[model samples]
Target: MNIHLIAVPYDSAVRGWRMGAGPEALLRSGLEDHLRARGHHVATEIVEAPDDGPATEIRTAFVLAAALRDRVRTAREAGALAVVLAGNCGSALGTVAALAEDEPLVVWMDAHGDLNTPETSRSGFLDGMALAILTGHCWAPMAASLLPRPVAEDHVLLVGARDLDAGEQALLADSAIRLVHADAARAECRGCWTPHAR
Candidate 1:
């Protein structure tokens, strides 16, 4: 299999800080070499926002998304699997946008639900609203333009979300996205759930 490793080395629009350092660190740790040893052909690219202005969390995030979307599209057209290593979960927006025509299922595994809207996000952290944007729960105009169509909630599975805010919890309860607790996932190894939908 041909694999494209697309790295976005920025966290909250800042490079080389906090989670932003992760992608480079993983590269330096020789992840590409390890994958090559497994016999899969690998290629790498780093997505970067233009240095035209000061970086703000939200604006630069979308800029990065657009850049990533193009790169992912190019990789897919070349029949390579695009593996995105991103500092923030919002990078999923770019990936999904590139594959929107395929109507892919989304499996989101995170300690906290990335389900907050502008109205409910106390921290104003754009990353917190990533999944919400995908589900059309917030940032409607921008998300719609990027995603082509809203992803069906039933096609999304939010797993290991133990740190949900009240608003996120309420939204999850109302959404069709499957919520799988980390504990429940462990039990699944012992046949806690059948493959059939519940």
Candidate 2:
């Protein structure tokens, strides 16, 4: 299989800081070579934000998402699987938007629920709201600018999201999206023996 490894090395609008360093670090760690060893044809691309003045979390994130959307679309056109290595989970907006026409099912694997909206998030962290944006719970106009339509909650599966905020938990309980806690997922992996829930 052909793979397009798109890297977005930005964390909350800043470049190469904190989690932003992860994307390049993965490449330097021979990720491409490892994939090739596994018999996959791998190609890579780095996505960057513009140098226009100062960067705000919301603006820069959207810009990066738009750029990533384009690259992902190109990869799909060439029949290559587009795999994004991004620091911020919000970068998923790009990948989802690029595939919006297909109405794909989203299987999110993360420690945090990422289902917080601006109103529900105490930290005011944009990445915390990634899943909310994807499901049209918030940021409707901006999200719609990129995606033709929001992904249905029933089409989403949140796996191993053990660190959910109260608001996220409430939202999840009311939504159609399926949630598989970490312990239950591990139990499934181990067949008959289930790990004790913490």
lDDT of 2: 0.95
Task: List candidate 1 stretches off by more than 4 Å.
Answer: 190-198
lDDT of 2 at 72: 99
Residue-level lDDT for 113 in candidate 2:
92
Question: Candidate 1 residues 17-38, lDDT tens each?
Answer: 7898999889899989999999
Report per-prediction Cα RMSD to one decimal: 4.5, 3.8
**Residue 54's lDDT in candidate 2:** 90
What local lDDT score does residue 11 receive in model 2, on the 0 to 100 scale? Answer: 98
Top lDDT model? 2
Expressed as tens digits, the lDDT of each residue in 53-144 for candidate 2 is 79999989999999999999999999999999999899999989998999989999999999999999999999999999999999999998
**Per-prediction backbone clash count:** 0, 0
Error of 1 at 87 (Å): 1.0
